[model samples]
Target chain A: MTTAPRLTLPAVTVGDRLPDLPYDVTATTVVLGALASRDWRPMHHDKDFAVDRNGVRDIFLNTPNQAAWFERYLTDWTGPRGRLGRMTFRMKGSVFPGDTMVFTGTVDEVVSDDTGCGWIGVDVTLSVGGDLKTSCHARLALPTTDDDNPWSRSGDRWTP
Target chain B: MTDLSADIEALIGVEQYEEAGEFPVERGYVWSTCSAVENGNPLFWDDDVADALTGGPIAPPTMLSVWFRPHHWAPGRDRVALPLQIHFDLKEALGLPEAVMTENTIVFHDPVRPGDLLTTRQILRSVSPEKTTKLGTGRFWVIEVEYTNQAGALVGVESYTGFGYRRAGSEAGVAP
Candidate 1:
């Protein structure tokens, strides 16, 4: 098994763009997410119920799924060393099953506190076919050291 | 309608609340959810990766939401309905113009792996009535649902905001 490279802080910038992560929303996928989250709402899994009842084309993506997408997007950038401090998101549109969703984000801002911990703010968005499905702001705690080693110091804020 | 505040108080601050049924956590189900979120990472599907990170097979963060089923009410039993079906029948029951998922907050205490039996108990946090353009008067309810594993370990808590709306008299017949 190949281990992911340890991510370093101060590597990302305000203008840096996250890679576009693409995925297909399938019936099986939707049901699986609903089952795992224990969110057995019919609008997330039942096709007929979504169409006939909610007037939606298909089962929609739940909020937790959207948040996970953000987490994945950031983790891919920060690697294993970054820690997510907070995330706030708003679901603008419904993501029906079969809809291809793409997640993208940018480093909105960055700052360092008195303790030398790097605080990065990001504006992340999830889109389906060019339409915005969810948008959120996230704050991540990164290391201030330039050393490539993530474990150089103990009790770092990014450990957890 | 059933004294929402009172219903909420009875459910909150309780350690072990009863659930209607159990939903199995299958490997296929975990992969499916990860795929839907556009996450193709092998960590979620590959056993080798799972073993490296978690020291065992574990479910993804979003996977927990899919595994939760509503608390089913036996005919005469006292059970709080979650209105899970109302999301589908919005037009008939409330004539809701739009149902939007506004926000979500989740806290994870433990990892949910395969073979972990889970149960959920929901508590209504707050309900705010507001006005909308398409749907005149609407309500947004914040519900906090806590999930625990079979061993009585708190797995996570999911806070979801669901918005229900009704059509305005003037815009009721207007076609978009």
Candidate 2:
């Protein structure tokens, strides 16, 4: 298996744009995310309930499902050593099956804290056909050197 | 007619409910979640790789709340109710027929691991006055949910915001 390259703190720039991740959303994808997150909400898996009861077009992604997707998107770019500190997102619209959701992100800031933990700020947006569905702001910790692993830090050294 | 505005006003900053997950964190759950998201992070799949970084394998930090999500059905539970009770309470009180999540924020304090029994407590954060938007006339509310492990250490906290609204032409009242 080919391993993804580790992203070092010194390599990231304030304006670096991560590669776009486009996913063809499907009913199965929606249901899988809900089931994996253990969210049994009907709006995420029951099309009839979503259409007839919830008045939505169809079953859409749940909150945790979206969170998982965001995590995947960020970690994919940061490789395995990246650690998420916090994330905030706004859902402006729904993502239905048959829509192609494209994730785009850019590095807004990069900093090294007093504890020597390297942090990267990212702003991401999920859009379908150029219409915004969700916008997320996230902060993540990355390694400063090859031997530096953010996850290995704890106690006084792990303030994120 | 019930005064939803008044009722919701009284609920702000009050603890709505506290509950524990049906089961502890399981490796199978971590696997399924990773598979669903198509994540190939060694931290979630390869123990040796994770051990070098975090002492052992760790669940995705975003899964903090997932560990506390109650099962759909259990032996003792005879009926099914919506997961977040406070959201539905505002919906029913406001006569809103539909609700949608508008915003969410989560702060991760610790990594989750298998066998960790998680519990969550939810509190009503704020409630907005009724306003008309593209979706319809509705009030927005935010709920803060805190997650803790069996040892009572904080794992994460989430602020969830939702809008309960009456669709256009729906007979539901939005209160004066």
Candidate 3:
């Protein structure tokens, strides 16, 4: 299902903006994503509790849901050849139903790791209704050539 | 009741939770989660697609925290009656009980493949003094969770920050 053009290590630069991704949030997407993340926090699904008790507008998106959106943005752009190495994000605004979350990113830096993997740093922003929902940064590993595959290397050997 | 008087400041380096799931990374959970996130990457569902790349299906890295919940229904770490939220009694001690996660950071070390049982240890990294903000007067804290596999191989580390606040005018400690 990876339809995007596979981006190789040599193709990307430090100022490239990834393809903008748009996702519409509904009650189902919010609840399902929370459940899948094994999150049972009331505010993520219970509208009544979130509004009356928490004073929020409605049932808002949970951390994992936002996290998944960030992951999708990176992997979708990298295609199958790239792998996620690290991700960090800060949630500023709550995302509710009927909100359209737009994900955009710009490559911040590029470096070569010791293990022959190309490391790419991206500064990402998730905005909804002209408001910033989450600001994120991630380091992705890309294969340099057809044979420089990150998938083939396995067995839990990596560092921070 | 009186606000928690316990000296919560003394609990800076507590390991609040060490959690793990009973079963290994199963296909059912992996596929369901991918579907929920709308991640159409074949590496999550199709075996042939994954086998061609990473040798087999792998769990999404975003599910790292999902695999390490509070350990409510597992062995070794059965939901203990831990002191106040954030593991330092600070939330209760300050009369600010409501909490919301404000930020997160995850470092992926390796791919989590099927049949690999995961384990995690959460440590109370830091807790800042009470501060006044638009929401209310609250304290900010950080909890770091380290994940590992069945063979004790390091998997990932997640740092989650939360702000526990009490609305203004609701309590005396709240800011106007």
Candidate 4:
């Protein structure tokens, strides 16, 4: 399978928009993500437990599941070389089965730190039916040049 | 600090070290996770690609916490009603019936690879006094978990903030 080409620092600009990622949620989607994350909470897989115990409409996506989707969305745009430095997100609502989750993001800043690390700031949102579910702010490291690999930086050279 | 109750105040800055995950990271598990998320990042799927970027085939950075998630059931271990012990503790302490995570911040430090065994230490960062939110009236708390690989190298750190509240009309007013 092919992946997006590696992104270089100079290629990015503030206000650059990432391609929209849309996913159709289903019971299988929720359960699979939970299982993959090793989360065995019934509320993530059992509808009765979710509806009765949790008092939600149905089983919903777990924390790590949503984080996985956010990482997937960001990496899909930056390709493999764009290494994440930090990510912070606030959950506003739940994303349940049958909801169509859309991920939209825009570049907030681009900078080369004193250590020569290239950083890109992004603001992202996960929404369902135009209603917000989560808002995210992420910082990732990109290559300053074709030869520079952000992953190679460590210790004092790397600081998120 | 004055707003925090005595019980909640005592938990701040206390770190709890947890046992290692049951199994080491496995390629099969990693592959399944990638499939589940529909993530086609070659770093997670192709060793050659990953070697070029992250030094070797590495699990997705997002999967750092997945490595330390406790099993739902074991041969001798009792089944847990909740996934997180702190959540249970906070609920019991604050007397809140419902809880939800509001925010999370994670910093990635090291790549987690297949065959790596991971462990975690969690600390109670802070707790808020009773307050009203759209969800209801309750308290807010923040917990931070630090992940480490078998070699004792820090892999990542996650600060999770949650709200434990009672729905409207049920203990709805602010704390007395």
Candidate 5:
């Protein structure tokens, strides 16, 4: 439904470490993300505007840009079956062009439910050169085994 | 004990609202957003794939923030939307004109379908007192939003956190 349901490892457990993803934050990504989210704030794309008006070194990432990064990380790890339940994050500093962001996380909690789904929590961080830029707490509803599709359920049945 | 704290204190529970009625949910926008992020989730675009689950194409849950977002132009296409109201004013009053959004929490209660006209309201939740972090001393505040479709069905909710801070200095709230 939502995910591809392609490859899944054993049901995740607490303390399981996710793969480390190191990416270069480029000007294209910064600007594209702003456009995609429809966040027209100049600081996200116009370097001159950022430094001249906002007082940052260069054009930087926006909230939706950061959200995209986290979204990709979660879906990539859980494959297509990982349904996002809730996500909470805090921005600590700015992520600028030429910065390499390393994403890492650990499984925080897992709850087995009768609805044939497993609710998962992951605490994650996005850092550049060892300086933390963002921290997030996310809840994902993952299918148990292959047939457990969380997307087909009605709104009244959504899990917490 | 920084002067910013008291100014921020005056803002707790103050709310500002921007309303958009009966908005269209376009497939192109959803496809573009998912494509930009490199998310291959077929549910966003493939009707055959989506039909297998949602009975129709479904928007990515993360797009909840995008739909019903107020454009730079104010409603009725009259003029540029007024400068961000409470958020900008609070930051200015605190003398921390420079601020960053450090936290966001979004919960999806319902799937967004293609062509669903959505409505939403955003509220200013709470503003914390000045706190010192590695970045600097600043105030953290929450903006809560609730989304519903034209049928009056709930779609989702989001709590976005903004941390407005000044550079660290010798002040009591500045982090070392």
Candidate 6:
């Protein structure tokens, strides 16, 4: 397995761009994801149903799938010490099994909490073939010092 | 067919709550599901990689959806309704000839991590009887579910629009 890049809290700030992560949405992939999520929605698994009934040419990506992509993009940048506070996205189009989705984002703002921890806000987007499929804004909290890392200690409570 | 419409109406526009069983953040489950969906990332499976990047054990975004599985109508019932999967099967069983998912949306207010017990409340936002093609007749129903942790913090809200279709010329007296 490839070693993931070293992610540090202080190193990230406003204007940092998350690396583009690529994924292929396939029939087996969509079906398995839907089954794992227990969505049982036909457009996610049944190509015929999607095309014949919904006028979609192929199986489409589900809401959870899009949310996952957004999370992946942010986590790659923030590392573990960073805690996701909130994320909201609006899906604009359907992503099919054959479509390649690229997840990317940019840090838009940063703030300090009362506990002296760092909080960063980001704007994220998912695109296929140069068309924006989804866009989101997210907030995350990170520790200023390694010792202050929230996830470092046991029984540390996470707050939104 | 029972007129669940009234029951549905009473439930509609009014929020009804249900609590889900506790679920651990299982890295294996996340990896398997991501792989099945062709999402290849060491962060989902390799703790070392995830720890190196995030500083702790973390779940993928798709992991939030997985919680919906292993849930049954009754508490403690492990029977999998596999709602999305069953919709497909229901199409086949009813011989309705066709069915489709028109839209779906999920809003995340908080991150769902390991060791979190999720409580969900669902509200039938709306139901609209609609027109369809010759293969069958159908209706569109919108349901929104809010998921909160044991601490009563809202985690996420998932909204789904589902279509149920019946086979042409086969809809006189069949049970829904």
The lDDT per prediction is: 0.64, 0.85, 0.76, 0.86, 0.75, 0.64
Docking class of 4: medium
Global local distance difference test of model 1: 0.64
Which ranking of candidates, highest DockQ first? 4, 2, 3, 5, 1, 6
On TM-score, the leading prediction is 4
Candidate 5 runs further than 4 Å off: A1-10, A113-116, B1-18, B21-23, B72-79, B82-102, B127-140, B162-176
Alpha carbon lDDT at A33, candidate 4: 96
Model 3 per-residue lDDT tens digits across residues A1-160: 4423387788889999998888898999889888877777788889999999889888988877778778877887887767788898988888898899889999998877676667889999999977998899998888777666666655433433
Clash total of candidate 1: 19
Superposition TM-score, candidate 5 onto the true structure: 0.80
DockQ of each: 0.32, 0.62, 0.54, 0.68, 0.47, 0.20
Q: Model 3, range B78-106, lDDT digits (tens) per residue?
A: 45533123533555556675677777789
The TM-score of predicted model 4 comes to 0.91
Collision count of model 6? 12
Candidate 4 local lDDT, residue A32: 96
Q: Return whichever of 4 and 6 wins on TM-score.
A: 4
Best by DockQ: 4
* Interface RMSD after interface superposition, each candidate: 4.6, 2.0, 2.7, 1.9, 2.5, 5.0
lDDT of 6 by residue, A12-80 (tens): 778988778788767776777666665666888888999998898998877766666566567666654
Error of 4 at B4 (Å): 3.6
Best by lDDT: 4
Model 5 accuracy (lDDT, Cα): 0.75
Q: What would the per-residue lDDT of candidate 1 be over residues A41-156, giving only the tens digit for each residue?
A: 78987889999998988888776666666777876777544546556678788887779888888888888755566768888888989999888887766656643322222233
Question: TM-score (0 to 1) for chain A, all models?
Answer: 0.85, 0.95, 0.91, 0.96, 0.91, 0.85
Sort the predicted structures by lDDT, highest score first: 4, 2, 3, 5, 6, 1
Off by over 4 Å in 3: A1-5, A152-157, B1-16, B70-88, B93-98, B129-138, B164-176
Error of 5 at B40 (Å): 1.6
Superposed on all Cα atoms, the candidates' RMSDs to the truth, in angstroms, are 6.8, 3.6, 4.7, 2.9, 4.8, 7.8
| Candidate 2 colliding pairs | none
- TM-scores, all candidates, are 0.64, 0.86, 0.83, 0.91, 0.80, 0.62
